[model samples]
Target: MNQPVSAVAGIGPRNEEVLATMGIYTVGDLLTYFPFRYENHEIQPLSEAEHQQRVTVQGTIHSMPELKFFKGKKSRLTIRILADGLLVKVVFFNQPYMKKQLILNDTVIISGTFDRHRLQITGAIVKPVEKIERGGLEPVYSIKGDLKQHQFRRFVEQVTDGFIHDIEEVLPESLMSRYQLMERKQAVYYLHFPKDEQAFNQARRRMAYEELLLFQLKMQWFRKNERQAGDGQSKSWDAEAVNAFIKRLPFELTTAQEQVLSDILSDLSSIERMNRLLQGDVGSGKTVVAAIAFYANFLAGFQGALMVPTEILAEQHAASLRELFAELKVNIAHLSGSSKVKEKREVLEMLASGEVDLIIGTHALIQEGVNFSNLGLVITDEQHRFGVAQRRTLKQKGLRPDVLFMTATPIPRTLAISAFGDMDVSTIDQLPAGRKPIKTHWGKRNMLQRVLAFVDKEIEKGHQVYVITPLIEESEALEVQNAIELHRTLTEALPHRRCGLMHGRLQHQEKEQAMADFQSNAIQLLVSTTVVEVGVNVPNATVMVIYDADRFGLAQLHQLRGRVGRGADQSHCILLADPKTEVGKERMSIMTETTDGFELSQRDLEMRGPGEFFGVRQSGMPKFKVADLLEDYRILETARNDAAKIIQSGALFEHDSYRSLLMMLESDIAFQEEKVD
Candidate 1:
């Protein structure tokens, strides 16, 4: 923590520049740049190595390498090598160029799958003797362009050997001894150039624990003070007003919705500020939960602001709330990029003068020109889409208004707690009664005519349809359907029905109008992109056809399917897929198997791992350099429990170990402050 990467011996200028690209500027960063995986290759005599195991054997070729193919050019090539006085047979599958690369009596090193019974090596990596990272177990680091694996490993070893003592201990000695974790400095030494398998495992465990501990400490601090203000008081929720608002809605609230509503109201009434994440599957009614929270805050004599990601979603929220809160007689104002000058000016005047009770908008609502007289509650939909700075800007407009974030993406339970631990999470798990589960089917793209016929039939039933593709137009690089051409084809095939096109690239007014036409039944079928996946609500749309379904993740595919089945009528989601790999095929199959978002969420985590699920960098959660939430979940539990103990003990800001913990967290604290600034 105290030394720059330049302090590391033998790190010359070119290597220093390469290391910097990987965010390894300080000795601490370089020390914590742990290997992603490891290879077991002990340098032993060939006769002593176990059978069917991979072993790195260094030797000289004893016979001429021969290339032949009895089955055209697809046959294997065989070579013979001498290692430790043993004839090690080597084979390659159809890589005939190997015969030209190595000749008889050539000294080389090959790591391959060994057939110990026959002393044969197959599917091996043959490198010149100079390039091998010779040892017992070799660590494999994640590679960047022009960063050779062996060279990077050697550089890391050189640093660890010379400067591992520079890594300060951050965990308390009591916890370290209690958990039987490796010492801090020892962990850095073992993680990079581990002495043995035992040391390697211990290093991984200790490092994973540190990442989780840091994350937990960060979240707990945020739970209390992310949007802190001197005034930590808000009026209690009006029970009568809440009941009255619920009574006005034509449909009854689902049990899940009612519970989440109660949770939000508790936070609103708390003496401390409210920081809550409202999570629900698509069509699970988080909007209504957020709506009542907004209304409750308004009843407490304060204004409310709801920020959405897209302009289209902002408009839809405004329209829906207008009707939902009609009987409440609350003055609602809406602002977006497309708002006319006069309307925008009027809305700003009302908001500044305290005439607006609740306002709905996109990012435009956070503009410096827009001032709220008394903003009490801020509900942001699609929480991941907004950065910390934007949310901080909105909070500045009010006296620490209660913050609520809603996401339709059902996060796996482990992720929900770890990533959003700072914010108390309330999930609406149950859908409204009588809402039929959507029927899902998978087919190849060659069956497009059948899908078109089905869309026409759905239109005949007085329902609209959605056709979602991944791109806006045909790309020279990608093979998937794009909006422009797909719309043309649909219009020609379904000549009797009106078709509309929408995508993010379209003009704001054009996108809004297209969505309006789809909602009003003027457009019988909407051919669009993922822009419609979230807030474009059309109850009459009963069928969803996703093109190239394999291209989407399970969570995204679930959201797209949620576009339908909103009405009382039965809905269908058809996946048109031509998957290119086993992974894609499995993802599509999972979509067809069930409609439970939470179940699909867990499955997606297993399929994509934590790095891809929710995106490690983009989810607004702190990045982990060592721990994987999905794989190292046990370590996370232990860290969280210990962190809670440390918090209860009230030693987080005291003691040498705790001092380092605070120093380690300085960057994260600075980042949060930067956003508010």
Candidate 2:
């Protein structure tokens, strides 16, 4: 099964290179490359077919196939076929060679879109009835570059026939009996060429279960190994002192906040190192909860470090922490890439000397010169923004310090389990007291004047506004507004208001200055891209206007909306978009209907699958070929439970039943480690 593609029959160097482009390097890859969908060859009458419906029609050629040569090498072949006493025109593009095969009066099966209004069939696949297997399903694969569907299908068929029996089973016999699953080899073969719908369903169920089970086992194994690597320091702190500090806060803590804080403190005092994810919506008092955790870490005689994504966010967090810890006398330091050299050096010295109890910074905290005398806790804000290696680098600065990750982007529960199953999760489901929900409105481009008038009114009331554009600069491809052009236009439209522009293309200092100007109310309107989507809080910024709002996902739209409604006063989010699709319109409607991040996240996951929900690359989510995190959540839950039981029973390494599973897990771990390196 592990043999290279060159070992296969009829596959030469050229075909091998093409297969490599599709990630089919080994025979095993070829066998397991399941088709996305299957097309049934069951014939249907033309009279029963709806317009633009995909159907298979068996017809006799009624006219000679006309082949016409077009621009450069392009060609088209057209023919007339009679099915159910109805004559339909069949068209094939870029397939002039098919004219010779399609003979007049020959019975052929054509499968593609059937347009009833035009009496036309756009033929995707056409084969003579005598040569084609009737009442069978044809697999459709996603291929690229020079490899046609027939060629790829032949490759998979050949591999399956030759190596199907070589596929080893990972599930134990007990599980196989309990679940009534077919053999792995049979399932793999059936997935490529199923005899019936039931066969295909069984194959899919077996394969999906195996993939999910292996993924869960890998997560459980890694967690077990991490816990066994070293003993966590049992940090002790005064609970009454922490309570007193929380009581001293200017605002009361929500019940959700208190619960999450309690979870963090409980983890801190345990001998097991804490690896937790704290999720909350924007302006849900997560920062305050983090402050309490830092205070607890300080009381335990261990320094804590907070790492954020941007300098602007780091500074904001620093200011908030300073005010929150004022009476406690805890020394806090702020560091960033643009910090003055002398100040940075002094901060580093104080950190290494154990003088700074808490430090908040951007990626600068993980730099070479940064060190800590007793770093016991590390908190990364907007955790998804940082890569695994970046987080690991900061954690490596200390001796297995407890790690806490915070993200304002609330992921759905299904994704949370699949992506962060290795760590514990705590959610702040409630917002702080007296915080009014942001009012959202959808507007068309024709209503720009009205939206601008609303912005002007908000500015007159001494509040700032955020004008979000989808692009940084104008492009011929997209007709939406760009940040630079929008900034110029807004500045011209409202001459009395000051407009500041910020985007990813700007220098760190320039972006910082823009944010500072906006924070200081020097800029009444800020026209920016999605750079300000996370952790840029300004209570006076009461209005958010997003142009081309349909271009963004639901989660991102929710995050942008969260920028407003940070203060007690009522806020508004104006979505200026003329959506062309139902999905886009639904997204705008959902944004206007609710401000709950988790609900929007779930809807977003349902709309755009898990791979795109958090961006597969940075999300640390497993890329399962068969199982879907959203659709197969119940299977995932079962797999998780089964894996936990297997690990707890201490039979994974000791019993023969789990030998193959263990080997597969170890190989996956090695591959992951290689990727990280």
Candidate 3:
């Protein structure tokens, strides 16, 4: 089983072990590992096969020559062959065993890179004693560990040839015909071995569409079940209380914000449980809207919990909410792992006794002993920062609380639909009045002194500065500055300057202390990582210097830029980029061109394409292998139409075609029902 014979077409047990060591074992796995590319032999005639554009040559081996060693460092074997009445040279490198496999007058089918002077046959998988048919097309697959391309391709062809008839048609005939998709069996064969580019395209389309359709079907069923099961539970808030909260805001709300708030309040008041996603750009006052929501519920004699991803952010929210609702007479509490045991015990007691109207914290809000007597609203900041389980844990604390998730990351509208199809969406596109745009500028590393001077100017004016670095640690390959190193350098450069350092490696208390110092104006400069991308607001910080701005995505840069321009004072964002590549230049260009986060997000998708921007690992958006949220907008629209049609027909539960889809969705519902805490 471990020999080279296992990979070769027909070798004995003794050869199998030799092959196994090279990593080839079962024939099936061997076959799936295809070549990266094919050397097309059809470009030139067989006579000029060696010189031909790249064609397969069919000829009889005239002689098997002796092995020759070159410079005692390399080995080579040459065979004289006749093809189409012309003589050609077939050469092999470091393959001494091939001499034993090939004989004089044997017909050979060889494939490889070819030049006019020589036929560079990189592989000798097929050595027949007689002339055989050559290639018109070839198959390629991603190489697997211990798998050689030549042997893998041949094995796949053999296995596929044998199982072609056994393949069951998973797609119905009517659907295939309607969509003009290739037959199931033919698609499997053609996908591995395409006759032409057109065939390849058809096979790819069918597979991509099928995968997306299946995922969409599953999402649709889950959404239906949720709406049906979660209906008739949401209670109304006091309208007078909500209107009064809105009226008391320091700045007037934008029309978009007002519309969103109205929709959310209405949903919360309806018989159906509220499941909504609130999307907006950075500094769009989403938190203010959330405050109004919590106030509405608070006035209705219930509690609301705002869950953030970090302790710093949770404390920030608690402070901001307090300021926003100071006149509303709402009692708010902050809870986190950092809270003292006595403090946490007191907060939990208040929560269980219905004394706390609004609570803000990180995961501590979902602690085991923390219970809510009248929890009616659940709000999560930076929704993607926390995992699915964390959100469910908060939901478990309430009696089917109305979940409101907020995110400053602007996703393409098409993606926003599918990713959050289970919930209604409210977008705040317009910024509030008096919100100033951060002036963005591009500069080189040499201009660091000028940027520092600007920071000093801001500091002299009684303002603060945030200097963001791409990395936390120093590395030889990276010429750009790092947070830790820059923090030391700047503090040294300006001896009188009080600078604070914040990064992920720091303990929670240390980070909080650093941030608190910055917030209180004790520190004139704050050097930190992108971990400060969320809801930590310092209105007094008026200058932001981002090093290696190109290294960050446009969406992230937008968030970083947002850290400034929060006060009435004019703020500036200095973007430092190396512009080493096209990608780097493109990303920086976006920052210099636009202050609109949503617009930058769209540009990022267009430049980098959606595949690199979204995935299960990054955005945790639904993973659609071939369906791009930006490019596949048409398909998503079609899926929406199809869903509406099916639902309108009222035959989803009665239709056999949807039965399997419904059953598959049961698992998602069951998973959601589990006690997360």
Please identify which of the two predictions, 1 or 2, would achieve the higher TM-score against the true structure.
2
* lDDT scores of the candidates, listed in order: 0.84, 0.88, 0.74
User: Residue 248, candidate 1: how far off, in angstroms?
Assistant: 2.3
Which lDDT tens digits does candidate 1 get at residues 99-177? Answer: 8888788898888888988889999778777654434667899867588987877778777777777677888788889
lDDT of 2 by residue, 1-677 (tens): 78999888878999999889988999988898889998887777778888899989898999998888988999888999898898989999998888888888889889889888889989657977874542377788989888888888878878877888899998899989998998999998888888888898899889999998888777776566556534677798888998899888888989999899989988888888888999999889888888888899999999999999988889889998898887777999999999999999999999999999999999999999999999999999989888787988998899889889999999898988777777789999999989998999999978989999989998999999999999999999989899999888888999998999999999988998999999999998999999998888899999999999999999899889999998878999999999999999999999989988989999999999998887877777777777888878998998998988888788888999989988887786533551221
Instruction: Point out the higher-scoring one by lDDT: 1 or 2.
Output: 2
Residue 235 lDDT in candidate 1: 66
Question: By summed lDDT, which 10 consecutive residues of candidate 1 come out lowest?
Answer: 668-677
The lDDT of model 3 is: 0.74
Model 1, position 636: C-alpha lDDT score? 82
Candidate 1, superposed: residue stretches over 4 Å from native: 43-53, 57-61, 64-79, 82-86, 91-109, 115-119, 125-135, 143-145, 226-231, 667-677
Best by lDDT: 2
Q: Residue 597 of candidate 2: its Cα lDDT?
A: 91
For candidate 3, lDDT tens digit of each residue in 305-388? 999888888988988888887776799999999899999899999999998999999988887998999899999988867767
